[model samples]
Target: MSLHPFSQRPRYSQWFTAKPQTVVVQPTTWCNLDCTYCYLPFRRLKHEMSAEVSDALAESVAAFADGAHPIDIVWHGGEPLALGPRKFTALLTPFEELRRVGRVHHYVQTNATLITEAWCELLTRHEFRVGVSIDGPAALNSQRVDLRGRPAFDRIVRGIDRLRVHDIPFSVIAVVGTDGIDHPEELLDFMAGLGCRSVGFNMEEAEGINTDRQQPTPEQAETFWRRTLEWSRCHAGELEVRELEYLGEYLRMIRAGQRVDWDRRRLDPIPTVSWNGDVVLLSPELADTTDVGYGNFLAGSVLDRPLTDILGGAHRLRYVQEFLAGLEGCRAGCEFFDFCRGAQAANRYFENGSLATTETNYCRVTRQALVTALSTVAAKEKEETV
Candidate 1:
């Protein structure tokens, strides 16, 4: 008999190797703010995760890490800070243990309203990367107020100052409403003055209970972004302005000779598991049934199904495919598609009805803005050269 049937197979097999990166976890669906364009409207209440659910989530995260994949756990709304220091510690203990064995890295995305000294201590102790949501200054942040209609700018600035005082590393996330569109330079300058090492700009998306469609037009958006990018190129200092919408265009302009190996759609994946054992398909926008594309795409409860199976299931793949197709559609037809990642899932759904079929307002704004700005830059450069 042959030593063994097909026994001499190669030692290395693609199937046996591991794929890095995993899920982004949402610890709760609750939030402190009632921003006009929030995607998680239903998350206004205080919903805490039971120890049982936390334990199950920890196990699931570890399973992914055990497979040679480095797991990343992103703590998000409503406001994870609402969990309080003691409860939050309880929630993170299991993951912290896993981190010692090189299983996971933790990150927190917060509004900075509830950030306290204790919270900062926990974050620094765990070396968690913090991303705080603050629009621009008082004027720009007015729309990001709490349910009581009080502006959160002062509170947010205080939280930021606390972080800086304690030497905790953090980044800022600003939402560009119509007002900010007209004053992009002022907004950019405001954030730059905050001493943030990195800043992310988000265009307002109409979602949740507040259905006000008050975003800048495509032409206006284009102008705003172009101005912001020009400012960045000249006076960014040590700060890195991370404009997700214009990342592709910047990369193309600066690294034209190099092949860009990035997929903006894949920045955050679907089946985002929540604290209440629910799994949402896309961002918080698609989580509420009132939102345009809201459907019961909840794969399985964290307490019920294996995370690996849920992540690999047909439903999850379909959701991602839908988003990828939308992105491709923009890439093929739109002039500024390269700069904006089509549009966000929520924006597409609320504005269009389907994430896959929608033409994003952000896309319109980005393309128009980028092309106009680049043309202006080229003209200026030509004049200088002459």
Candidate 2:
């Protein structure tokens, strides 16, 4: 995995984190419900991971798992639970020994429509952290529908209720598009009432197959974050918003005059393994996307090569090289570089059509807008104190 002399510069030497903190595994791609804004390319297809794939993944995980830092094995997909409890449990069996030694932790990002008492028992017994994808109340969640185009909200809530009954704590991931952004207070109230551990907002973007997305304007984005921050402050400590939490930490670091160590600020590889065992490094959103230049975004297959070896050679990929160059551009240009480090690879590719570029509507709305909102609020608060 050698690079040109220019790429061998000190700054580019450690561009990517060799040991990733998280690995997303696609157990299956058979999603029951059809969400309107899904970006997955093969969501309609049914593909289950073979036992050999899991065994190979376990071997890769074992090689990376040191006792000090526990790697998060996130089971993500077209809907991981679509595989059902029994089959899913078999998949979990491979990592059981690694988990017992506290070298790995399991997490599942699911739609929650398939959750049952059996699923709850499996999740609890395995201590798997659950993340549910629900936009808002029934109206806002209308986009999540069954194959018959019927709203799946009732079923989703039913599944969540089962989780509650079993005392399983879970976080909520709400997709906020033009519809839900304006009603921040209402959205906050709805999420807080769910008794979720935390809330994360995912702004809709034109990614993968979901092109022609209607994105919010810059003003609307800023206002939405401003209002959301205001609402969060009013109900302080009642709900933990992921963006606001990160904002707070960033502000504190800035105030303390802490500069980013560019060398140490390497991007996490975040290897996303497809059901067939193909590994896509960096963003999980890059798993199935393809380009003429980058091919199918695959670094290598875990079944054929060790995960560590695949990651080691990741920097040599054409897209990864371009992404590194883009990061350098971002570091040199954007004022928000310290906050975001560098914006996401998927956003740059999907929205801007190239990974070798910087600035996109996705980053402007999600990253810059939040920073502007919080900085304004903090400055005004400081004035009042004086």
Candidate 3:
């Protein structure tokens, strides 16, 4: 029996048998809308996940997570709602058996363009937490148009309005690109108007199929966040920004004396099953993207074997080994490693050209900038109030 290397230390091991906390299932590789910055490599492949593959996951997860926290299944995609009613229900049916032994929490992250009353009823019936990807207002969403280059802003908003009308609780996720970086107030006001309690801001990350997008400069980001944080403090009780949420968790961990090192052991801590039965660990974004140097990162196929057998086989993969090395290096060298746990591995590979490299435009703009902005605002506010 081999000890899980990531247990109680930050070293690499030849094998690990730990259970993942979440399972990200991509039901299809086909997306209706083609955003300018979409990173899905197989969006045109137009494949969908089968029912048998879904069962393989539910069975394997129930086997290991019987007494653990609620097993989370994040329905991701090219676009999960693209599966529609029949296919979506078909996909979730296998997990029904697992509810007998333990709780299984399901979540769906969608583009909000395909949302309708029927979709809302299905989500309400199952009580699945919903996350809608809408980048603020219509102007900001123009970049996320259909494949034919027609703007999808009106349709996306209409879908969100439908979700609201259905009384279904959901959160919003917006990507902050170069054009949207300086207009944080517009983004903030738009979401606040929608009555969203929490929002996730994903920068136009240089990763996968979208490496050409420019990473925001520190000055541009700092200016945006400082103003945003000030606005957030005014609306503190009404809304919780993503970075502020992370900051709150970090502060709580400090008070409770818990370590803030979100290590590689827990990075994704979830398996992402691609439309075809191929499994990828660490990051869901890495599900279909591959590099020639690392070869195919398909850890294993559920159609051929159970997840338990496939997870153990990750120890032999070169990408996993190199990524672990990068994680170890980030912990040792980077000052922000404690807070971010080396940042996302896919971003490092796309920007720095290797997983073993430390720091990237992503870590700087996303994690480091937020930390600095929040802390700075707190210090300034303290002096004035005192």
Candidate 4:
């Protein structure tokens, strides 16, 4: 048996495993809305995963389970809710046993336009962690529209209202494009107004089908993050900001003289099982976005082998090897390696068109910028205390 090469790294030796901490399952590929920055290439195809596939996943996912930390089974989609409540519930049936045993926790990333009372009931009953995708207020959210190019902001907000009425807690994920970067406070206020438990930001990047959109300049990106962190600190305890929270954790790790610990093995081989059981490892955005150079990013299939086995051999794939090399590149050349790691595989592939390169606008803006801002803020706060 070959030892996973990642385990050889000191930071990964303790927790390296073939099983992924998160499994992204695509229930269906039919999205109800068209967002300007949407990355999915097959969103128009209304394909749904067969029950057999979910059964296979439920059976195989047990091997990935840790003691108290349930493996995250994220039901991502073109719009998972596009499957609607009935069809979606049938899809959930296979995982009920695992969910009951506390071995798996389900999360859904939805556009939230289809969020109805039935959807809220299903969400509440399943106890699934809900993540709603809405960029911001109506003016800021013009990018998200229906198939007819009708703005979806009002419908999205309506769905959120339903979730709130049902007491279904959710977190919001906003895509911060160049236009939205300058309006952090406005975005923050709008999202916080929705009563979401937390918020996360995704910078508009040249990824998948949305490659033509203009990205924020490095200076603008830095200013956005600095102000974001500043606002997050002021609103501390009111809402959790994902990037800010991650920054705090990273800073804490540094303060304690601890190595990064690979941050869940650098999220290696995060299996994204498509409707037909085809697995795309690492970045979920790579699903259905084929590059012949990268073997279409298809690592393996749950139909052919257990997810564990595929992940076990992930390091041997040619593209994965290049990605690992990219990590080394970051470690050696970039000072932010400990903070940003190698960056996301999709970012590397989409921005530079290779998994073997390092340093993307994404890592610079999201990771490096956030780290610098947080460090500066921490130092200033420390001085004030002294």
Best by TM-score: 2
RMSD of 1: 6.9
- The RMSD (Cα, Å) of candidate 4 is 3.1
Candidate 4 residue pairs in backbone clash? none
lDDT of 2 by residue, 42-99 (tens): 8889999988899899999999897898899999998999998888888888999999
How badly does each model clash, as a count of residue pairs? 5, 0, 0, 0
Predicted candidate 4 versus true structure: per-residue lDDT over 246-299, tens digit per residue = 877877776886654535443546789999999987789889987787789898
Per-candidate TM-scores read 0.83, 0.95, 0.91, 0.92
Q: Per-residue lDDT for 271-302 in model 3, tens only?
A: 78988788887678888876666666577888
Q: Is candidate 2 or candidate 4 better by lDDT?
A: 2
User: Which one wins by TM-score: 2 or 4?
Assistant: 2
Clashes by residue pair, model 1: 29-78, 30-78, 30-79, 31-78, 222-369
Model 3 RMSD, rounded to 1 decimal? 3.3
- Ranking the candidates on lDDT from highest down gives 2, 4, 3, 1
Q: Encode model 1's per-residue lDDT on 1-386: one tens digit a residue.
A: 11221331221111112223645566666777877667675577777777777788888777667525567777877888878889888888878888767677788889888888898899988878888898888887887888787787888889899999999878888888776878977887887788887888777766655467678787777677677767877884656876533554566755765434434123444446676766665565555354223335465677888666555442333444555556667768866555555657666656775656646665566455566776777687899999
Ranking by TM-score: 2, 4, 3, 1
- Top candidate on lDDT is 2
